[model samples]
Target: MTSRANRSRNNRCATALLVATTLVLAACKAQAPTPQPEPATPQVTADTSAQPARSTDAPLPSEDASLAPAVTTPALPSAFVDKVWKVSKSGAVEPGTTYVFLADGTLVIDSPNGTPMHGRWSFDKGALVMVEEGISYPTEIIAIDDSQFHIRSHNPGEPVDIELVPAPDQPLPKP
Candidate 1:
């Protein structure tokens, strides 16, 4: 009878030890996950009413040699390259204003004042992104062809539809 009692006590102690071990293992495994960095928010100014000062001789966006290899600029479509397009109709840009998109991703906006506005241009995420004087405008390309290009501004209040026709003398870039 004493041996039976000792066996029962030993079994209880073994079960308690197993349970304690399992609890300790579970506590160690249940850790808070490491935090991840947030995505960068683009810096945009609120003064959308004022026109940015044109800088014809402005240097291109600086490219660091070390970072250039990792950073790849999405190429503009071949059909839109090296062409001078004029605004046939638009509320954003003055009608008859010419915009030249060079193959090297340089955008030349011939302002109504006749001063050329130089800026960097790139096609990103299915939108044509134009950055001028630190302001970035991502406009949706409605359609494009050898003859005409249509674009819609992302502005909510003053939404603009710009129609662009190729310059008479300028021809489409060779594929």
Candidate 2:
């Protein structure tokens, strides 16, 4: 009967399916696991934008360069807090990032549209330290002074120094 023939055909099909699954599992077990790629090392670039051009006639701060007491924290005044400051960094002119300083003391930084994108920044050793994040040309620019930020990208080549002048009435970093 046709029903008997169909039952036999289905059994054969079921056996074929089981065999196929077993072979797939065996093949998967035979293959070795792929290794993950190592993370790329960070390339340090010298950003001289923070670098000051000490005038030959300019006098130094003090005869004794002493370190501040660890207990004493010299605070950046709240007068500039919760305000936006326009930054020209790493040899680049205006149209830079606007850092909004909040009262609680966090920073909200806006990225530059046209210029090279600098990375994340935090105050380190009294100056701003920037690490290249999600940027096309990964650059780590450090703040040298109020007007200068500098860094050179070893990966991309060519050291870049940026000069940043604070735009008047710019909001301070967010709290």
**Best candidate (score: TM-score):** 1
lDDT of each: 0.68, 0.48
**What TM-score, computed on C-alpha atoms, does each candidate reach?**
0.50, 0.31
Task: Estimate, for each residue in 7-116, the C-alpha lDDT of model 1 and write its tens digit.
Answer: 99999999999999999999889678889889989998754222222254754345434422211222236766688898998877898788777778787878667877
What lDDT score is found at residue 50 in candidate 1? 21
Model 2 clash count equals: 37
Per-residue error (Å), model 2, residue 104: 7.8
TM-score of 2: 0.31
**Deviation in Å, model 2, residue 8 alpha carbon:** 99
Off by over 4 Å in 1: 1-76, 155-157, 170-175
Best by lDDT: 1
Off by over 4 Å in 2: 1-83, 88-90, 93-119, 134-156, 168-175
Candidate 1: give the clashing pairs: none
Candidate 1: residue 156 lDDT (0-100): 45
